[model samples]
Target: MRVPTPRLSIPDEPSLALPRSFWKEFARKNWDREPRLFRGLFQAHFPTLEEMFAALVDASERCLRGEIPPMRAVRLYVEHEDGPGGIPYYSMLFPLNRNHLPVREDGNAHAYLERVTRWLGGKRFGVILNRAQCHHWGHWLQMRSFLSGFYETVGVPLAGADSAVFFGNYRYTPFGIHKDDWHIFYFVVEGKKTISLWPFEALSQREEVPKEPGFIHRAGAIHLRDKAEEERLLSQAQLLEGRAGDLMYWPDSYWHRAEPSEGLAVSASLGVAFRPPEFVGAVAPDGWPDRVRHTELPGGRDWRMPATLRTALQQRMGRKSLLALERERTTEWVRLLASGAMEGAAPVLTEAPLSPHEWLLGSPARPLVSFPLPEAQVLVSANGHSRAIPAPPAVRRRLEGLVERLNSGAPQQVEALEEAFFTRLTARAFSRRAFRELLDELVRWRAVRRCEPPASQRR
Candidate 1:
């Protein structure tokens, strides 16, 4: 008997079809060779790019209201074509603030957005928003489901992964030639981008190329300005152009650069850090027994013990072991891929619900509290099994306040509760999804009940 496979919840209207065979072929051909490029691989995956752009604009407004942590969620850069070698130069590095925009006051988010959009339309600069999962519920759900499907299909252990949205102008290349440490899956939502890639080994061997510093995260084009050097490299470069809905993958350490063509460009990039089977033991060990007991471990097992022990071990044994282990694992994985052993299996597809933001907007507000009985506190229990879970102080306080408001016989407005209470709370502001998850857990624990609005107020 064949075992039934579980399905992923992907978006319905703008459906996605994974190019499993293409990816498998890619793995077979260039897994261990120099960097390669594939053009127009997924030109029909996302058709709602405009809608997503509108959602991003609204999210940016919410971010300015202190409803979210701006710095951690968004990055803004102004690019000018005046840098060395005539490449675009970046201003306002990481952790961007309102001051980075052209607006006079931080409160004028509308103006800031308008100016930024205008700049992008004129091929002036670009912006990047990180951790998009925290800002948009629907986007987060789709991304999580897609990632799950990708990992299951590929049969690789994911170390770390994240989604970021980028908005730029035509002919804009924010960064010069550089390489990232993580594999990237680039999805174009609007406009087009041309990518040029060069092998790291080939670039490193050129006498005119300046040596990169050990601590530098990305090597830029400042050192490769000579026309002779640029021409020589271009002679052997691989070029790929991608349009809206197209998907492209770039392996780690592949030196490449991108420039938008035609009009304003908008795209999403999913960065993935994979752990080969051999490295899985070092990176993610199976310690469920210890994990449970440790949670049961009284007083948190001297919170600093793990770090202190790790420091001591590293000093005594040297960092060579960890480095060598990583190198060996990477090589092994590359060999498997080159030998056609790492091709992803055919995936099982399923329809996913609309994102959280869309669902909540369409659904009517209802009271989630069932019957308030006791004061809120961190709960701890022990038997043959022991468990301890602490409620965040802010959430506990909010629950208590909700109970008070309900007991006073005042009618509660759902909109007020979401915006005034949940959104305004700094701790909860970082993630709407987490706040909603907490509500679900409360309902399951009999701490809250779904109360519908009166017939007169129902929409």
Candidate 2:
């Protein structure tokens, strides 16, 4: 199914605050415009490039310290000079520790960083940290704050969002010619990246690129390796080059590939899924609210709607009415699919569990202590979905103080923290139990952990 190629917009005099009218126009006019692209969308909105680089480094350090789970949050890639296909290639399946830190049998974290730096000196090596907001400590707080402001400015209900940090110096892309399902706002923090985008219509007209399998929700690159084929496609491609502080946006399903033009580059990609207000009405029947209280979708994924609403609607609606609604919904989905606005993954709700340290805090005699996790924030519902929210001012101050203490590599006593908390904020501000619960919540969320004193200091 070929769709119209959307016009890419690059505004002059870029501003951090885009008028709400811009977003409204973008949705009204370009929502179904395949391969929607925009440049300088976040001008002067985020932290400076130097700050972003520092944040990436800080996040890496935290990962090395067994804070961020390496497997889930970090991906390492090494590009090979020569491959069987005579094309630039890279491997992403490199093994890492549970914290996603690179495995170094004989050396420490410093050694690991040095080894990586040396490896990337001549070879094409890259590191990608997913959910960077969760690990960059306070360095990325500005970026998170900017996103919150953007959400309010756009006035759209967001289903989910996340940020990934990419670091590498490479001339080749790992996956060639692919598309994403969610809208991506990409910021080039350092170095330069050249991206080539091709419309689906152009690819369909050529035989060089075979029809790949249908994509599910997950984002994966469709491998297209023939140089001659790439040349053919480039004839009709839209080329974009981004440097530090430049921001770009591309709607889902826009076939594109990116490669660094310099030795090293760092960029952040923010993916968002926006649900229109009319979506619920379009998908659910009139009595859906009363019909199903809670239900599960296929694959045991929890449906956001209540099962009772789903059950009641299923039972009350006639087959014909259901079929009619299904057809309408299908049409809507097709439009969304064409524009890359549909969500690819199911919404996940993770239950944070209290850490062992938090469990010990209840014991007045044990003197258990806790330290905040780097860049940790509580997830709060914004548009019916959980989003990262910064801690309240007082709580943030306390956590920051604790983080500073932990950074000193010294174990702190729980009673001392309690005293500090009481002194900083009045005792009436939070009851002892309430304070303990707050600490427990932070522990459960992996934003803090219990600390044990050194054996020499234990007595």
Q: What is the C-alpha RMSD of each candidate to the true structure, in Å?
A: 14.4, 15.1
Model 1: how far residue 370 lies from native, Å: 22
The CA-based lDDT of model 2 is what?
0.48
lDDT of 1 by residue, 359-441 (tens): 12111111122111122232211101111223466655564454334323233444454455575577532355644544444
Flag regions of model 2 displaced more than 4 Å: 1-17, 28-45, 65-70, 97-117, 137-159, 204-220, 274-431, 434-459
Candidates' TM-scores?
Answer: 0.52, 0.53
Determine the C-alpha RMSD for candidate 2 after optimal superposition of all C-alphas: 15.1
Clash count list over all predictions: 4, 17
lDDT of 2 by residue, 212-253 (tens): 664322254555556565667667678778777777776665
lDDT of 1: 0.45
Error of 2 at 257 (Å): 0.5
Candidate 2 matches the true fold with a TM-score of: 0.53
